[model samples]
Target: MNPGASQEPAQPTPGKHARHPKAGSISQPLLFAASTYALGQVANFLFQLRLLYLLGPSQYGETGLAHLLLVTLIFLADLGYSSLFLRESGNSPDWQHTWRYALGHRLAATTVLLAASALGWQLWGSEGASQEYLLWAAPACLLALFNYSSPMIAEGRRLAGLLVTQVAWPAALLFWYLLQDSLAQSMAATAGLSVSLGYLVQALVNVFCSRQLKLWLPLVGKGQIGAAVHLSLIGICGTLHDRLTPFLLAPLAPTFLPFFLILNHVLSGLSGIQAQLARLLLPTANTAPGQARILTVASLLLWGTATVLLAGLLIKDLALFTGQRPWLGLAAIVIFAWGISASSGVLATLLISARLEGRLMRLLVIGMTDSALLQIGAAWAGDAGYLLWARMAGVLAILVWQLKLLKLRFGLAGLTTLALSLLACVADATDWAMTIGTVLLLPILIGLLRQAPCYLPARRAGAHP
Candidate 1:
């Protein structure tokens, strides 16, 4: 372990969140992680843009769908062992042993998922040799799964694994796409193969950096399995919340799927900001003990809400320029859902860090049940607008429950941010002039700015009540 790293997890009291590490201690890793992740996402975006140009909208949507399915499958295969490892083994002296044990179960699970995917492809796939592509996608997903928690477990002490995982895979994937002269098979199949090769390259580089490539071990204790499975239940529920929109849209309104996919792709890039923030804060949670101050919680929500509003407005203009005007209402709903999810996710991370995973998972299960019911009703209604609205309502339901658990409230800063977000959504959904939206939001924006001093260093002193 790196010098001064904690040798045991911090045990905060029940019903409280983790304390923040000193800003200076976390600043370097936060900067390094943010910059590298941004670069990697840029490469990924360029790769997607190139693919869309090469294959056109309809085929691009298929490729995106295939990618989403493969990603979800990988998460399902994970079964939460890696998450359990991050939560438990972060301060273990024999961390490598714990990693190997978790990895062994992950490999076993991956094998089963791969077999199931192959069987489903053979039975349902329309294109020839698509199963071959599926095989390629598996290794890529496996490598990604292995590397997912490396940075977190390292606790920002060594970022070499993170640099390799974030920058190398996407850059190599883009490079491979550039080298391909033409697609010998369908675009989706070719993309699967190319992406898999890129992951292989990533794994090779990571192994060289770490000086080991060991995977599984005979460490299948019942306690380990049960704990990991419990965590995986939470993961699967979160997955349902995120991927459900596309899943429901694909079959019910095939024609609208591409537009939603396009929006998804763009919005996902913006969501990375929140993902990285969670990652940066997670290490603090593992190492420190105390409840988060109100200022910190409020700032987190405000920042997340502001990001979604900005991203929504920007995407709205992009849609108009691309002549996708009719889909702006759909965009509004998607953006609104993202804002709620983003805020809720930060709180969820805090709860999980506090060893409240079981509680969080139960809430997620309840939320998913509600969402599934709403989605089914929307599908029966046979209107795409209603389907999206139903999904957003479901997301809002989750956020409301989370607030109750955390005992957070919409203070002035939060309320202003919320108003601005809603205003942006209304403008897009109603086809109001962009200037009208901006002018209306200015007062709320000014109020949010005035309240920003509450987040400054001076405001964070004393214990969180």
Candidate 2:
């Protein structure tokens, strides 16, 4: 036998086949992360509720707008290429320049942000409503910048600072909350102090970690600047969703703003959980067997279920909707969020693993273009619903384009999920009725079949593999 074919097992008896040696699997990290994320969600909700109840709607709206602007500014400052840098480094540990280059852009951008903030303060000097909370705002910016570096650690060692800071920030804020006269001042003061302190704690810890890694920060040379710019460009796309929020919300009715901001805050925290999973998998798939594909498939189903179920439960709930029902538009948003998850495989993990920026960047450009067009659509529609519709359309465009790049196929489950989500968005239905219908329909279409033949193991007789 040829040497390459020599490893074949001796001829087997009829109706039997040689067993292929299988890869080992352990799922401790997945369990740990899922549990941690679930717990974190509970804590985060409780914490925010405390603030919302204390501050009331008006102050809450003001602070919420400030918070949105803060997030958008932070996202823009990141310059869109951080994701590419992170995925690059994780995909190849030997790409030693990745961190140095990425950090440089972040530091430079952060410095610019600080200067701009200071100039605003100097020029306006509390003329607007933002001044009352100025004390709380400055530190928040620094904290956001510092928190960005935690991804470096998360990728490198699965060491992340957010969890620790998550607990600490709230505790610190709660401490501040105890001291004030009314809810607004308390919230404002606590927000400022807690943000600064939280960032201080995280940055200090990260500095210590760098020392442990023996990172020679001083050695980054002039050559690294070009690399930083390239990486920064990539970062810009990855963060555009966040950057767009302030702009989208700014032109809308101010009364409805706080609710939308609160809604975004909840979604953001939920997505943060997903973000951590994405970060973990993008790095580990290089060494771990079968992770990339498994995660891709799981993402489609998990997010599909989550999006549909959440929309169904909240669609009729009087509390979640601040004004008129935009049931159809919200449903579209739900579907888009799910579709985006399926599409993430290409925009994120696959591109990272392959270390090919050209394809990813080209794809991102197309997606970003649609994003802009949808924003115009949202503008024309003239409400939160319009923006949601625009976003839904944009993400679906991303889904189709991304799938084309990978030449991947989705089964009946994914297609059905997408279809149902569209219907839910376009038509109004009672929450309970929709839930029962989906629960019955989803399992029959997706769960019972349990087929992923292209990637998963072959089924044994009647049982799904």
Candidate 3:
């Protein structure tokens, strides 16, 4: 750890709904984490570019499906409990107890995953050499418990340990990938190895950092464990919120998998900006609602704009980038774009701050059910864009219902999101007039954002909240 590096802490606010100024609370450790996460993201994005060049479409589709399954399995392995560590870690000063519990839980998870993998192998590993590779991924997933705790450790800016995991693990994978000659195993194997190795380093680093920081998890009763499990359950829903897209596309069309995956990646990458801002803002929302709202709205607007720009600029070449049959249908892309933009991660984090985390997952379950139904319906319809429409419709329903649940009284501002969703659809079908109408209306809508407490103001010198 860099002992000389300045480290600042984020104190949990005293008030129920207020927070200290976020700009100051967003200390070096958090900044480093946010930057590293983004860099790792971009690197993975570049890695996908390489994957497209090498894997082409069909295999890309297969790879995407496999990845989705892995993610889903990871979800199952954790039983939605890792996030408890994150939230709890943020408030707890010493993490000796937290580490003890986390280590115990992770070990249990790892054991279960190992047994399940063994059983799965006996039952179906012989499906194909390709599938055997999938079965082989179990060990890596089991070992990935380390990364799960990185967020927890980074809560107070003790980020050096997490940094080692983030930086060193990928480097290790890149080295091994170059050394490996088998093209077939390169992508999947490298990913599995990278994640496991990375998390291993991360876990080790967390141990050292916790020791150096003199942090210890507080000893707690079974009741705390239960509460942690409850929050972690809701938090797992947040993870699945991003993890299930490829699974939806898998049975629909193998060729469309990579294309849809690319679209999902773009949507996710853009939304991550929102999530990053949310992390910075949520801790402060308890002290400075107005300020946090400013930051939130700005984040939403930036991501929303980038989403539009990416659509206008890359819609044509997006398929070419995938090397697979570019699943055509700008309308589908529009639906996807608008859906993601409308459901910003900032909003999700805000919900968490509001103690509405369960509802977020509750809403997500509804959307997932709707998405799944749409998947089934699309399969029956034998169409290309049906899933897109399904997603659009389901997400719109979710937004509308969530809006109602949130009791958002921003009459016109809420309508603006709906109107934008419609305009994205209009842009899809060459309805330029409608699209432009929405675009022209954007500024007026932007102004209305001030009415909502979702955005926060930028910090200035000598700022105090």
Best by lDDT: 1
lDDT score, residue 35, model 2?
40
Tens digit per residue, CA lDDT, model 3, 1-465: 231232222222112222443432334545555555565556556655555666677666655555455545655555444444545544556455555565556556567766774575456433432354365455556555544344544465534433443543455347446645754555556554554554455556655654444333322333245444545555455455445445555666666667667776555555554445445555544444533453334334533543453254334344554443234444345444444444544445445555555566667776656766765677567655675566556555665565445433223333554465455444544535334544555564454343322322223356332
Per-residue C-alpha lDDT of model 1 across residues 92-198, encoded as one tens digit per residue: 67666666676677777777877776676566553433344455566676775545445344555334534665654485466466646675665546666677777
Q: Across residues 2-100, which tens digit of lDDT does each residue of candidate 2 receive?
A: 211212111111111112112312256653653455454554456456556767766666556555555556666654444544544345564445555
| TM, every model | 0.80, 0.72, 0.70
Q: Which of 1 and 3 is the better model by lDDT?
A: 1
lDDT (C-alpha) at residue 102 in model 3: 55
Decoy 2 TM-score against native: 0.72
Reference-based lDDT, each prediction: 0.61, 0.51, 0.49
Q: Is candidate 2 or candidate 3 better by lDDT?
A: 2
After superposition, which runs of candidate 1 have C-alpha atoms over 4 Å from their true positions? 1-31, 87-94, 121-135, 148-155, 182-187, 213-219, 286-322, 431-435, 444-464
lDDT of residue 153 for candidate 3: 49
Error of 2 at 187 (Å): 3.8
Displacement of residue 62 (Cα, Å) in model 3 is 1.5
TM-score, model 1 to reference: 0.80
Candidate ranking (TM-score, best to worst): 1, 2, 3
Please give the distance, in angstroms, between residue 144's alpha carbon in candidate 1 and its true position after superposition: 3.3
